[model samples]
Target: MTETLLLIGILALFGVGLYGMMILHNFIKLVIALQILTKTAVLAFVIAGEMNGQIQLGQSLALTVIVADTMVAVVGLALAVQVRRHFGTLDIRALSTLKR
Candidate 1:
């Protein structure tokens, strides 16, 4: 019962993240949304692994995801900073207008 509730909560988090990514135009917000989406998958895996009695497997997978996500976030933020320096705004709509 607890696991089911947790899963439902995670699903809601995923939905919120997806909505933010799709509807928000800020580059930083998009990055945060992506992180949230990634975290939901990690959490789902951890929860399933625990339920299956393979906690080690889940922990390892979650750790791997954390490391990879850290790298991605760093790179993404760097790119965002560069975009801001070059374009003067982090809005997706503003960046799209640069396609001349």
Candidate 2:
């Protein structure tokens, strides 16, 4: 029962993240969506470990993911800030237009 609920939650997070990625144009929001997707993967790892009797491995993987995700968020936000300062906007469409 608990596992089922967790799986459902993971699916929900993934869907929300996917939707955000598809519909949002702001870099910060895109980063947040990526974070949500990463978290969903982490939660799935933990849950799989719990079910397979390898909780330690699952936890280690989740830790690694968290570290990587943190770096990604930091870099993404930094880029967003730089883009805003240089281009005067955070919209992805505007940035793309400037590229051409």
Candidate 3:
């Protein structure tokens, strides 16, 4: 029963992340949406490992994912900052229409 609730929670989180990704246009918001999606994956991994009696492996993988996700967030935020500085806006559609 608890696992089922956890699974439902995970699904709800994933749905929220997906909705953010689809509806948001700002670079920073997009990065946050991506982070939300990544967290859902990490949770799923840990839960699956617990179910299979491989908690250590699952935890290690989740740690690795967290590390990678942090790097990605840093890079993404850096890019967003640069884009804002250059274009004076964070909207992805606005950036797309720029000319060299």
Candidate 4:
């Protein structure tokens, strides 16, 4: 079924994004991974509801998630900028090393 395939794709994207988040050392990379993971989760919710013929709750939740994700992305970018400024690099390891 298309629904099943959609679910699987969503799960794959979520896992891949998390993996990227874990392996990436750059602040920007982490932010991008977080965003991708979140959007995939949101997509899963919406897709699942559509498949089940009950879309109201999913749509409402997705709307809220979109708003939250937007705010989080803005804040995250600001934090990244600050990190770049303080350390002159976006690499988290380098930032940590600078503390010594």
Candidate 5:
């Protein structure tokens, strides 16, 4: 029962993240949406490991995912900063329009 609820929650989080990614035009918002999607995947992996009685494996994988996500976030922010420096805005549409 609890596992089912967790799965449902994960699905909801994925849906929200997908929606945010599709509807938001700002680079920062897209980054946040990606983070949310990453979290949903982490949660699903943890829940599956728990159900299979592989807690340690799940934890280690989750930790690895956290590290990878952190690295991705850092790189993404650096790129965003560079984009802002060169373009003066984080709006995706505006940036696209600048391409002549």
Candidate 6:
């Protein structure tokens, strides 16, 4: 049914995002992967709530998740900016060798 397909799509999104997180070297790509991962998780909950007919809980959780994801992404982006400012590059390999 449509629900099953939705589940499969969400799974595929999660898998791709996880793979992106592992393979991508750029900070922007990593952040995008993280966003994709978070979105897939939130989407699963929303779909589950819809399938089971529990409206409020799913909507609230999805909203909460969106807010939290925004906060985390903003903070992470700021940290990334700082790292780049100090290190002068966005490469993870170079970042790994940073003294501090």
Model 6 residue runs over 4 Å out of place are 97-100
Total residue pair clashes for candidate 4: 0
Per-residue lDDT for 39 in model 4?
A: 97
Q: 29-81 in candidate 3: lDDT tens per residue?
A: 99999999999989999998998999999999999999999999999999999
| Tens-digit per-residue lDDT, 1-100, candidate 1 | 9999999999999999999999988888889999999898889889989999999999899999988888888998998999999999998787775677
Candidate 3 Cα lDDT to native: 0.95
Clashes of 2: 0
Q: For residues 1-100, write the lDDT of model 2, one tens digit per residue.
A: 9999999999999999999999999989999999999999899999999999999999999999999999999999999999999999889887876667
Error of 3 at 95 (Å): 2.2
* TM values, all candidates: 0.90, 0.93, 0.93, 0.89, 0.90, 0.90
Score residue 42 of candidate 5 by CA lDDT.
84
- Which one wins on TM-score? 2
Report the error of model 4 at residue 94, Å: 3.2
Better of 1 and 3 by TM-score: 3
Q: Where in model 5 is the C-alpha error above 4 Å? A: 97-99
lDDT of 4 at 65: 88
Provide the overall lDDT of each model, using Cα atoms, as 2-decimal numbers. 0.90, 0.94, 0.95, 0.88, 0.88, 0.90
* Regions of model 3 farther than 4 Å from truth: 98-100
With a 3 Å backbone cut-off (N, CA, C), the pairs that clash in candidate 4 are none
lDDT score for residue 51 of model 4: 79
Candidate 4 lDDT tens digits, 1-100: 8888888899899999999999999898898999998899789779867977889988888888888988888998999999999889898898665667
On a 0 to 100 scale, what is the lDDT of residue 50 in model 3?
Answer: 93
Steric clash pairs (candidate 2): none
